[model samples]
Target: MHRQIAGKLTGPVTKWIVLVGAIVLVGIMAPLNGKLIDVQNNEASSWLPQSAESTKVVEQLTGTVDPNDIPTLLVYHRDSGLTTADLAAMDEDAKEIEQIKGVTAQGAFSPNEAKALIASGAKVPPLLSDDDKVAFVAFTFNFGKNGWQDIPDAADKVRELSKIDGVDVHLAGFGGQASDASEAFEGIDTNLIFITLLVVIVILLFTYRSPVLWVLPIISAGFSYMISGGVVYLLAKYADLTVNGQSQSILGILVIGAGTDYALLLIARYREELRRHEDRHEAMAFALHRAAPAILASAATVVIGMLCLVFADLNSTAGLGPVLAVGVGVTFLIMVT
Candidate 1:
């Protein structure tokens, strides 16, 4: 039954149809690769379980508390105690930071405030460490829905402007973490795809021992990744699906690796069939007939297993379900086709 279907599908005239369809599919999806991250849900609240205390607290605070504000810290340090000039410089730095767009910097606690706290028997926040080697500025931002997006830019501006001759300034807290995460994901689309392809190419070259053979699988895997990204992006955008850097990164690897596996198996069977059959189409038809079941079974198992993550309480885990299922499903179709 499989052989009959393959025969019709791989027939000389039908092969061109498949080829054109694949070309069209890939052409439409290629541009979507760069848009995956645009729909990613990087905010921590998106991942936590709704019933969790932290999640509840976050929910309660969302509209009532620092609704629009993102608190940030800037630590300044020196080996020697801060001098009068250093304190003055610190004050100036805070003022400059206040001028940053999308930010609202606050001045550090003054000496008078510190004295009042000490007199009141209140344990002040240890902005200045016991050794007097550290002091920090605290601030908040009211960037609204897009506050997280501005974190990296605001942090860069803070770092650039807070420089002192002898004091070291460091951005800390949520804004700092956002800046770090932004840096980490800066070129993830290009870098992750390139590295995955490079490694796959190397392995495929050795596995097939044929230059031309490796290229086909690589192209197929690349298409699979592009399709997966496009599908995931659409789902994320319209369906309110949760996407994050971790899930998106894993989606690329899963598509490439799984697609290549299917490609290798099909190619091996095709090569064997080529020895027994004169026509390439007939050979591929027989190869697909013989190999399609195992490949489909494996892909189904993986897709089903990943889809089970939909039951997870955490949004990130739940998001991985459809994300990876889409990847494996795309890879399977591309490889089988």
Candidate 2:
């Protein structure tokens, strides 16, 4: 059964058809790479269990407020403590932020306001630290709809507007974290793909000891990664699959690693069959017959193990299950083809 299957698959007509089909598929899916990050959800509530109290609060607040608003804390500090001028400058900066679209300015303290509160015998504004060396201004910025894609832009505007001379400014809170994370992930996928390719080429060159032969596994792995990415993107878009930076990054690595392993196994068996059979088609048939079972079992084990994460309480973990299982399954298909 296996030999017949392999013989049909290796036929010249079938080979060309598969090659053309693969090229067309890749062309259609290549544009999806840029769209993946746009669909990603980084909200803390997305990852937590629905049963958690925090998650419940988030759910309750979603209907009543701008649930997509991210809080930004601007901290200004000076070793000598803020002068009256610094406080006045901070108030003006806060007002300036209000003019920037999407910002809900809050809790800006000027020296005047501070003095008035003190004179009124009310507790001083919490903006000033006890040491009087640091003060904070806060704002909530709205990112309408699927807003994480706008976080980096919003953070940049805040950082640019918060700058004041004679005082060091630091951005804190969720908005700041999103900006830092965006910077870190920028170009990460491209660099990772480049490094994976380089490493695979080096290892394949050493293993095959033939310049022409090393390209085969690399091409197969590349196709697997692209197809896996596209499939995962669809799942995330339509299935409420919770993918964040971490899972998306790992998906690329998983496909390349597993695809290479399967390719090596198949290529070794094909080489051995070539030595024993005079016809290349017959050689491929026997090779796949001998090697496909073990490869299938290995891939199935990985897929089942990964899919078991669907039982996890955390949405991120559950999402990773299907994403990686799809990656491994696709890798297996590309290697065998």
Candidate 3:
């Protein structure tokens, strides 16, 4: 039955139909995928790291805390020990930070003008650290995971004013380092994705040489991308899913790699049929029939591999694992159709 279908298509018409089908599939998937990822990002960013202020405070209070994260510290010292000039500088620094986005709240260390706080005998330690060397500046930044985005530059700016001559400033925290790493990698990621897409396009053009033939893979893969995204979004809504900045990279890789692979397999079979037979419909049937099994097998293997990641110790990746797996599964189904 499969071979009989392969006996129909003559040549050019076989190419045209496959090309059109790919475009249709892509058109169907695009909008759906966009919505999925947007929702996924919003949901993840909203939930975990819930108490942004407390989280910042927790980071500040800890010993050996990484300076890159936000923390709320009870910075205090003898009123006599801090000069009036230094006090004014602290206020200035705090005000500048207020200009940053994602800062939900901001405040600083000021001796409680309230007689109750002063009277409570909680023992505001003068010279807040050992040997008078280090003291936490008591002001918590109103920040969230998203607020962390501005942290590196903010931290750098803080450090510039935070330590005047004769003041030892130490920053210890949780959220800052991750933000720094993200900022550091920003340029690299941009370059890599752009280069990767270029390479993929070049490869596609070289392999097919024909504009019409090249469109087959692009269109098919475009459809695969959209549908896969929709699957990710739906799972993120229903199941536990974490889509981070890395989700874009993961989705891009899966969509480009798998879409191209599926299209290639189907197109290769179609080409073989065109060479072997003379009728268009028959070639379409033959190509789809023969390619169906291998595509299914490859897709299944991909699903299996993705499932393995669900067992990962990382909460983020574990959530992502199932979402990505389902995405690939959806893409595979579209390819076969």
Candidate 4:
């Protein structure tokens, strides 16, 4: 059955060229989608540098969290040799803070850091609670009172001090904290996309028992996401928009479920028509005629539901809404072919 279809489709060169072209397109568009935009290690790995725009974006998302202050907490448990003498070790940092301009305050908090994090309401603590194992310190960097980048070199200085010996320390806050979060979430997005594709492949393999059947939906959905992602990147770069942490997961759900669903609906009808009509072309025509309406309706409903996100005030939700909508729309369009 597979060979019959392949023989009828014409030259292998045309198929090969089209297949290679698609892969090239996917590679190009993956970064534009804003999910795969990592330039790790080398000089370029520092793609999105800390700047006024980044500071402002963080500020917008975290209301009342001052970006210029660039605060990081040093938490040590009471059991981690954090006695009065160890607490005095923080005074060593006072010299580092004084030497570094825009460095506002550096002080040690005993086990009381937990209480401060829970009560002070300045910023939420990133680490977990372990009162016996942790002593905390808040290092406030005054970026010249201008903004995060203006404190001259506060984050760099914080990184420098984090290297102090004896006690274990982590330099965290708006700047370093955001970077850590981004790094942790990076693998999850790609895994989500792959998992979506994996589920689709499993469905196809079980239903068709043919490799060719799996290829169709994979090519269709992958290309649609690639194109949509490229457009997303352009929007992010030029329009100053953002694709938040879960944006790719949203795209994965839409692309995988809808793409496989469209393919499933079409294939089911095609099989039904094949049993009644002897000709493959006639069966295809029948299937297309019957399945197209349902596909369109499903796509329409998805678009309508997602567009509602435009009314949301949170930029992250609003950002994900359109990217996912575009991805669904792209899947619908690709299914047309």
Q: Is candidate 1 or candidate 3 better by TM-score?
A: 1
The C-alpha lDDT values of all candidates are 0.82, 0.80, 0.59, 0.62
Displacement of the residue 85 alpha carbon in candidate 4, Å: 6.6
lDDT of 3 by residue, 1-337 (tens): 2454433332356555755765665566566666553443422223335345654564565566432235444242442365556555555655654554433354444332222345776555432333433344444444443443555665666566555555445444443444456567554534654566677778888988876777656655666666677666666666647765566457766766787788888888888988877775666677887887888888889889988976665545666677667768867866655
Q: How well is each residue in 155-272 modelled by candidate 1, as lDDT tens digits?
A: 8888987888888778897778778888877768568878988999999888888879898888888888888889888898899889988898899888989998999899999999
Question: In candidate 1, residue 309 scores what lDDT?
Answer: 96
Q: Give the TM-score of candidate 4.
A: 0.61
> Over the stretch 1-337, how does candidate 2's per-residue lDDT look in tens digits?
2877888877768877877888788777766755778778778876897678999999899899777887777788999998878888888887777777767545344445666778899886667787879988777777664556666776677678777787999888777886787777876767887898789889989999998998888888888878888887888888888888778888888888888899899989999999999888788878888898999999999999999999988878888899999999988987887
Model 1 worst lDDT window (10 residues): 105-114
Model 1 RMSD, rounded to 1 decimal: 3.4
Ranking by TM-score: 2, 1, 3, 4
The per-prediction CA RMSD against the true structure, in angstroms, equals: 3.4, 2.8, 7.2, 9.9
Residue-pair clashes per prediction, in order, are: 0, 0, 16, 9
Ranking by lDDT: 1, 2, 4, 3
TM-score, candidate 1, is: 0.87
Tens digit per residue, CA lDDT, model 4, 1-337: 2334433332344445646766777788876664434211111111233344764566475577643455656544444545556555555654555566665655433334435566777575533344445555565655532342243245556556745455567655554564355455546767887887887888899988997888988878878877777876676667755564466567766787888888888888889989998877667666767777888899989988887976665556666677788888878876644
TM-score of 2: 0.89
Of the candidates numbered 1 and 2, which has the greater lDDT value? 1
